[model samples]
Target: MEIVSFEQLDSTQNYLIEALEKSQLQAPLAVIASEQTGGIGSRENLWHSSRGDLLFSFALPLSWLPDDLPLGSSSIYFAYIMKETLIEFQSSIWLKWPNDIYYCENKIGGVVTKMIGKNLVCGMGVNLKKNQKGFEALSIGVEPTFVCKMYLNGLDKKPTWKHIFRKYKLEFDYHKNISTHIMGQKISLHNAVLCDDGSLLINKKRIYSLR
Candidate 1:
């Protein structure tokens, strides 16, 4: 994988998208920044990136994945794969519904996926140290470089989307207070039903987190 590093940037996700759009960067490229002044978050929030935060954003052509892949669950698929890789290192890490990484009850990182033209861009952040925020750092220490390598490796596998969706669906029960917005309204996951495509069926409406 090709990587572009920056001492400081506005947002890794935005930069990566722009680079890919302009053909200034290629697929399977990772853009990492030491710090981000305008970090983005899923659910329309701001990601507060501080010192020691492992911010990563990568782009890949849509052809790299399976033909029947479900795009809405791309974030969960990538985040869960990262969690599984940490398990290989004997680290205790779990993923929340959709794309939030959690260590016990506290969140440690998050994943966001967007489709730009025919490419898929993934933006991720994992706090390695104290952030002085609501989220927690990873329970066990992991080298950022190692984590990035593992993530890219997982992406290379190009596992079937259904395979990933099945795994992620099993973990959704843990997030009892599902508070995600849908169609301009905050909807709880308690009454929502998890579907085979990794979407939620609430009030007969199918909702997906395709951010």
Candidate 2:
């Protein structure tokens, strides 16, 4: 992946999406910034990332993944590769179902993936170090650029969805007690079921991560 660095950016996700539309950027490209002023989350909620934190977005060719892959589970696959990358740095980050990165009880980072025509765009934010008053940070001594490189290396393998899903399901226990929102309502994952495609089956309804 090619790295395009910025001292400041409104939103790497939006910038990358627009760049892709204009053909100004190529696939397997990343747009990173020291801080983002207009960060967003899966919901309309803001993802407030501080300076010195890891904030970036990467776009890859959709065809890089398997054709049979379920679109809803892209978050799970992307988060899994990132978690695997961090693990090599000795960071004990666990992925919350759907794709939030948590360190123990506090969230240290997260990832969200979206499709733009033939490209797959993923926005990621990790708190590498914390200020006195802020969300928890990784403190793993790993640089954001190194993390990006590691993620790209793992992604180069193009692992199948089935392979990632099989491993991710085993880690669902980490999220058993966490709270997740569904349709703007607070809900618990204690009774949720992890499907093959990474969707949570709650009350017999298949809740897709992408939505």
Candidate 3:
């Protein structure tokens, strides 16, 4: 993946999407910033970020993705790769079901993915040093560029969905005590069954990550 670094940007995700749409940027490319003034978050929420945070967005052609990977669960697939990358740094970061990145009980970051033309773009924001009022910073210190490179390297490998899902299943027990929102309603995962495709079987309703 080719990486483009910046001191700051309004939103790396937005920039990549717009550039790709305008034919100004290409796939297998990444945009990283030291800070993001306007970051995109889940459910249309803003991901407030500052210096020392890791904010980046990467785009890739659909052909680069694993054949078995579900489009709707792309968020989980990419998010899990990041979690694995941080684990190599000895950080206690774990991916919350769907898209949130958490350290123990506090949220440290999140992931969002979107399709643009024949490419898929994924944006991630992790608090490496700075923290908001309710969120927490990363447990271990890491340079923003270094971590983004490491993550992109992992993504470049294109790990199969079955391989990633197998490991994610082992950790699903950690989320049973938590609840996730669906259609604006909070639903507990206590009885939710994680499907092989990364969706959750909650109350007999199959829910995709769809982030």
Candidate 4:
């Protein structure tokens, strides 16, 4: 995995896309930035990226994955893999139904996936040592690159769905057993549902979907 680090950037996702387009580069590229000024979030929200946080984006060609797997499932698989990694450092870390990483209740990080031509770009932001306002930090300490390398190394092994499923199931179970705190109110995890189409059902209402 090739890593390109920048001291500062408007947004790691935008920078990565531009770099790939400019270079006509294929998939399997990573872009990391020390600071992102205009980081993105789901639904056009701004991703608050404070300095010292982990901000990175990577792309993979669609051919790298199995054709039968839906794009939404792939994102869920990647999110589960990442949640498992963070659990090693912070056991309190829980996955919000789809791809948001939460520390107890407050969001600590998130994952975003976008399709570019026949390729897929997965962007991740983690609040390691620092966090912006309205968010929480992991109680346990971790190196930014340490987490990044774990993901990249796993990818290097070119794991199949069978290999990923074992880990995904375990993390999904853990997520299910946990409770969710929304807007300062505690709610049971049973109210959350993972729909067949990869959308999250909150109180029987569809909420978020990877697509």
Whole-model lDDT per candidate = 0.79, 0.83, 0.88, 0.71
Cα lDDT over the full model 2:
0.83
Candidate 1 residue spans exceeding 4 A from truth: 89-92, 133-135, 174-177
Instruction: Report the lDDT tens digits of candidate 2 across residue range 1-211.
Output: 6789998899999999999999988887989898899887767568887777888999988777776579888888888888888777655678887778888778887888889989989999888888667678878776777788778788888888888888888888656887887778888999999987788899898898873
Best by TM-score: 3
* Candidate 1 lDDT by residue in tens digits, 1-211: 8778888899999999998889888887899888899888867689886867788899888888777677887887788887887677546577766788877666778899999998899999887767666556763566676777787887788888778777776678766565765667776888778888777888898878676
Per-model TM-score, in order, reads 0.88, 0.93, 0.96, 0.79
Give lDDT tens digits, candidate 4, residues 1-211.
Answer: 8887888999878877876777666578888888889988755578886766788888888888754456766666667677777877777776665567888767888888888777788888887765536466774566676678887776666666556655555555666866644434565666576555455567666644452
Could you give me the TM-score of model 1 versus the true structure? 0.88
**Per-residue C-alpha lDDT of model 3 across residues 1-211, encoded as one tens digit per residue:** 8898889889999999999999998898999998888999989899987788889999989998999999999999999998998888665678888999888788888999999999999999988875556457874677889999999888878899999999998888767889877777888899999999999998789998889
Candidate 3: Cα lDDT at 205? 90
Question: Alpha carbon lDDT of residue 76, candidate 1?
Answer: 75
lDDT, candidate 4, residue 161?
Answer: 56
Q: Which stretches of candidate 2 lie over 4 Å from their true place?
A: none
> In model 2, where is the ten-residue run with the lowest total lDDT?
84-93
